[model samples]
Target: MSGRAADRWAETRAPSLAEIEALADAAFAALPEEFRTLCAGVRIHVDDFPDEETLTEMGCESEFDLLGLFRGVGLAQSGEVVSGQMPNAVWLYRRPLLDYWAEHDETLGHLVTHVLVHEIGHHFGLSDDDMAGIEAAADDITPSEA
Candidate 1:
């Protein structure tokens, strides 16, 4: 490899959990205002990989099989908020997302935004087509734009 290329590679490190969380937060902020308004109590979390229990529940043979997930009641199921409701949560699997990002031409920020929007779409009780549209909208938002 070229000398400068090697030097740059040496300085590169995987994003830490905090960095990934920051990316998610930025991505969320970049969503259209109306969409953000609807996601009142949704939470976003980042982990290196899925836990064993999550793997078992999802029937995943490998941790890399999943990149992100949404866990909670969608808007369609809600009649009214109860006192004991668990806040809706979206999980981003960092390692798997990194793996996927490496294999594709998409930027890391765009991938993160796509995954975040997808999970939020689920929370909004949107269909696959609806989520795809949302992801398309989010993809247009680059890191600089965000």
Candidate 2:
């Protein structure tokens, strides 16, 4: 509703990686302060699709099988950062997420936020209560497609 008229969709294109990253940033920023604090130094990365290595690692037969992923030690495990160690990261697969958005009624922002929270929650070893809070925060931030 914010962009051009509906008749102009054919001239438009899918969201670029930069646009997706922006959406992720907005979604992340909308999270609760406490949750955001826990994710300090965590980087969010976006790619059109998961690489072959990632697909195999995730045991996915198709590229679209995974929407997002969290890679790194959970907060409940290790606290100290070792030299040259990779920082905690969340990967959002753009193409798959787009495909999913097309099939469902959820807004792109909401889906992205959902995937983000799931990954971050996994990183922090969040409890059910924490996850519920995350979901609520996401809902508050994302506008409904409906």
Clashes per prediction?
0, 0
Candidate 1: global Cα-lDDT? 0.85
lDDT value, residue 58 of candidate 1: 97
Error of 1 at 75 (Å): 0.4
**Estimated TM-score per prediction?**
0.88, 0.88
Local error of candidate 2 at 56, Å? 0.6
Error of 1 at 4 (Å): 3.5
Error of 1 at 63 (Å): 1.0
Give one digit per residue, the lDDT tens place, for model 2 in 91-141.
999999999999998788888888899888888888878887887976886
RMSD of each: 2.3, 2.9
The global C-alpha lDDT for each of the candidates, from Candidate 1 onward, is 0.85, 0.88
